[model samples]
Target: MPLRTWQTTLCSFVIAGALVGAAGSATVTPALAQGPSAPADFTAIARERMPAVIAITARQRVRERETAPALPEDLPFREFFRRYFEERMDPREALGAGFVISPGGHVVTNDHVMGNAEEVQVVFGTSTRGPVRLVGRDPATDLAVLKVDPPPRMMVTAWGDSDAAEPGSWAIAIGSPFGLGGTVRVGVISAQSRDIRSGPYDDYLQTDALINRGNSGGPLFNARGEVIGVDTAIFSPIGGNVGIGFAVPSRVTRSVTDQLIRTGWVERGHIGVSLQELTPANAQALGRPNEMGVLVAAVEPGGPAARAGLRVGDIVTAFSGNPVESGRHLSRAVAAAKPGTEARITVFGDGRTKELA
Candidate 1:
């Protein structure tokens, strides 16, 4: 199934992108005493946290190529027959949501929501609205940060642990769905560690939080009003919220957002190699049916992996002693690593576990 970006208002649907926004922390924040099982002051918490949920309107230029005008052959007067339309790109404004992450007014939202943004504006409510500056964006993770001069009484939201968020736990989402600002919806965590294959790091928290179009880059908070995920996409056949939505987990968002806040863009360590998944169908032929690994399909001659003694036909089982689940898992791990660092790798060859390289 193809997941749309949840970006709208430009002859496109409101549902697109698989996840949204920045997560603040990797550590677990405790839920309230009377958490999801027993509702307590839901309205109050929503009110307190509501200010952090901001609406975003990004105006972007849609570029189009213009070809030279063609003259008609049937016309007696070729000059009169010739016609041309001025080559112009249309400017469009897309609406999404974000939450404040810093006291200095750092906001987080989905990158897809701000496609080629020429200008951006953030609104806290009906009264507070102003132009904002783009801090950084990571399209690979569908996350971005914005710097806004928050109005008086605006507050920031804290990041909760998506890793600690259990299935069936209560979830709250706040965004500008259909450009309706400060809309709140409630549901539960449907599942965790779901891979919708949106990116190299595809671990998404599945929730039934009634996320819809224009909810892109919104915050999905737990019962304690802590942000655990960014509302980005919905799994709907009919474009409306069907209760199945996906969010980018805090564990991944936290790291990416921090880097973005420090720098205008993100940089990742590269290990040049092409990999094919090791699966049951093909693993049997390699004498390793049950074990998980990826086939080293192609190794660049002078690349990091090759220089570290990796060869084509090798089955990469682990990296730095951590088991690699798939090609994507290894790729994400390598990207997360610091550049110019030594790599510890384990592979399979000759029908046995190969020594670390």
Candidate 2:
């Protein structure tokens, strides 16, 4: 059967190269008791953290030949043409930056950097250095881990609590943009929980830092000199910084990076339901005064929502006690929920509020 127009109107979060600021207003930090806010000492922070920062280059392997097609014995074939293309151009090389996280040679970078890389190299500190090895990567969060056995005394960047980082707080970026290693840009946290449509868990810390091409997978630091975010993408049409950049929050990266280091990938709970935004017409049909909740267009058979008794045309007002304001909000909540655990969902159905497990 053809799906209804309302069902087709549903929107799932997709990767958009946008950095959404805080929902309403940006949150500012109070001035230090000593005096008015002072400029963050980027020099001091860079000095303490730059040694751990390393430049990463990913080399992709290009297969020069494929399986030869079988032909009839009578067909005239040209075997010389296949050998002629052997001296073709080499595969492209991708460049990005990473930082050492552990003493045992654990490093962190964006997964996209190592996505197609058959050979990975890690350059510690400045370019006047040796290479390292590629470990594991998590594409969902755009994080990768690399390992390099240095000459001992490897420096590391301390990770800050991303949950405590408020909007309007100072954010400093250090990365290799345009292949220039050890570059720095300064800005403020423009927003939080920004869904940049980059990945399923798209919660990003939006910043107004001057980020540009080649800065992907770099560190976003707070005034305390702790790493809070990883510079990944920017929102610009000209490919230059227009004072808007997005960083993967440490809250998300820490967990994903840890898992990637241990295992080879990160696992996310999936409910397999088609999520739709609550429109005025749909709300009216459900007897809602206004469009407020997310609608469940279709629940996967035997999936989490289906097992929880969620149904079509039901408006989910809350997920696991968190009030859901839109489809995007609800989707994030559900995606973050732990699998195999029952969650309470408040829904509006048949002109009445109902609770479903």
lDDT tens digits by residue: candidate 1, 214-278: 89999999888899999887787876778899999988888899999998887776777899998
Listed in order, each prediction's TM-score against the native is: 0.82, 0.79
Winning model by lDDT: 1
Q: Pick by TM-score: which candidate is best? A: 1
After best superposition, candidate 1 residue 97: deviation in angstroms?
A: 0.5
The list of candidate 2 runs beyond 4 A from truth reads 1-36, 61-89, 127-133
Q: Write the per-residue lDDT of candidate 2 for residues 1-357, one digit (tens) a residue.
A: 653332112222221112122245578998865734756467988888888887777787666655455545565554554454544546978888877778887878888877787777666664444556666777777888877785468887889998877888889888888788888888899999898787766889999987776678889999888999998888988867788899999988888788778777665556667889888887787777668788989988887667666689888887655678877776666655555555566777766677665
lDDT of 2: 0.75
How many backbone clashes does every candidate have?
6, 5
